[model samples]
Target: MYNSIKEIVTAANETGKTIAELTIEQECQLSGKSRDEIWQRMTVNLQTMQAAVQRGESGRGVFSQTHLTGGEAVKIKNYRASHHPLSGDVMMAAVQGAIATNEVNAAMGVVCATPTAGSSGTLPGILFMLKERLSLTKKQMIDFLFTAGGVGLVIANHAGIAGATGGCQAEVGSASAMGAAAAVEAANGTPEQSAQAMSIAISNLLGLVCDPIAGLVEIPCVKRNAIGAGNALIAADMALAGCTSKIPTDECIMAMDKVGRGLPASLRETGIGGLAGTPTGQAIKARIFGNEV
Candidate 1:
């Protein structure tokens, strides 16, 4: 929503409030609800998602992940046995379940951006960890989401969010940037700090490839989320500590775009090269596609 860093910073400072507060205010205005009501609604939404996951239906939108606790996994599996439609959280849970079961996934529905389904667990997982560990209030969580949204919007606007078009940079890179910005906001970081966090995340993942094994979102995708989530937290910490990027957010985004564009088609989720082209990858593809590699 903000066109520039200055605009974002100015807006955050205008009310002498954090970006989360501003974002919640905006959401309240749009929804015509009081802050308390909005917070309650968010809580109910999360609870509903949990219930849906328990019922074997994916409740949340894209990129949702179930809690990683053992009890949570049991609940998710019970829900799946009931034939519930997969919500984003449930979908993510299924991916995690696959990882636990040491199997591969079929089709992966990417979250907000087109990161593989397996990697979708990272952002929500980090958000959940923050909320649970820090006991962040609803307002804080929404504000974090808003802050992350800013970063994601920038990536979507300047670079590209589709993995098919921009490879893993558009997917995992953008997710990491969003996660970093959100983490910084949750830590009560300044707008500049949040932007810096995003820059660090994007810079780190500048030229990541999208090489799903056998055209499946499994293989490297599931594990990548955990790595991305950790990187996002680290980036946020560094930025909050006053570390700055030599590249501006916009320039960093542009660089990501350029790098993504230069990636070979085989590395862009086409399943023609990268890991997807390996002998094991071919074997997996043959098994899944029922055709000769």
Candidate 2:
């Protein structure tokens, strides 16, 4: 029912409710399902996300068929366990969680795509990090997902969440923006702050192309999720620190949409441009498909 970020915030303020609560209410109306039903469904998604993160951090991650992305999450986890990461534990943990989720995705493992499978890592990265840092209960974690959903809905409506239609900016960018706003709400920031977090997150990665090397969601896609998690954290922190986005979230999303559209067709998940166009990229494609590409 919420068409824009501002509208959702206004509704939340007027009703003295959370963006998560409003999102649940709207889903009830749109899907004609009871609140309990919707909550149960979301609970499953939350559980799935948690499971994927845990699997990735298990020190023996699953590898994709192409062996392109696999155990990097475990490597991150181990590295942080033994060494002082320059980015600190929180950021590294987010990176670990984000990479783990996407690695699992590349392996064809189950994951709850916040908006899309190609960009599944961002929300869980921040959400789980907050879960441990803030000691979030299961219900609270689910609320975080709903808050993310509210922001993602606005972006999907105005711009899109498909890499094919809007490039990696729409997939990873929107997911990161969703995570930023949701992280803000989970940290008890105001709805307006959540909107600001979303704006900053979207603008930070606008026009990111969706060039999966060798047409696989490995190479850059998996690493991009790690960066998306970092972006979400930075944006959320900025909003919580009383920072405001000069461009409203709705405008930021629109701007992202225009930029994604302006990108050449080669950049929009076609797997034939960007890194995919490089000589090494061509060699990988040839190795994978044997002249088929």
Candidate 3:
């Protein structure tokens, strides 16, 4: 199996296989499962994501116990219905889907964590929206996830994936990169273009910290996922348009790991710095926990 982003790209180039095909082959080898079985599971993941989006847009059971994240998806939908959106359908849908998935996670509902729950929203948000925007078939949508998973596998093995270990740069940044790679492939770009998309995406989010208010993945995490989805879309479009990253994809992932390691602990999901340390953030924590700020 390909271990690094470079290797993944090399294998795809050598075999003349799509990123999705390489990833699916690796998954089959790793899991000892048939291709049909793996495909079926990914289909279930897509269905779950679609359901969370629907629930989020419906504005039902969207609130958490702390009420930190909820109803934002519905608000976006309502705004779109009334006013002409400047961002257009795909972006608007991506934002809505991202927020919806995170809101579901916050509400303790079911969600398919593309890599991790805190960063889960990016993939589904863009994937489902692109399904309509690009007129992709179900098979193509599943292929998108596999392509993204290839990137994630490389990052997780080479650098890291958890915010606790590598800060939000590892979590949301990796997820955004993965989504961007997948989007490039889904749009019929080559494996090399997908890797470039991932590089561009992660490079832009290099130092993002993982500061959750009250240690809850609600405050900035939810909104950050929305932005991550947007970043993925932009990066994918850039790559498809023949834009390239000066830094290679593997080097970008390594840089993200280094940045995360250099970050202070307060910024790594500690809830003691960044936006979580703001006066309003402290007050919200106090209000939620019944403690003085």
Cα RMSD, each candidate = 8.3, 0.8, 1.5
Ranking by lDDT: 2, 3, 1
TM-score of each: 0.72, 0.98, 0.96
lDDT digits (tens) for residues 82-191 of candidate 2: 99999999899999999999999999999998899989998899988999999999999999999999779889999999888899999999999999999999999999
Worst 10 residues of 3 by lDDT: 59-68
TM-score of 2: 0.98
Most lDDT-accurate candidate = 2
Residue 222 accuracy (lDDT) in model 1: 56
Q: What residue pairs clash in candidate 3, if any at all?
A: none
- lDDT measured at residue 188 in model 1 versus the true structure, 0 to 100: 73
lDDT of 3 by residue, 148-188 (tens): 88889889987788888898888888889999999988888
Q: Rank the candidates by TM-score, best first.
A: 2, 3, 1
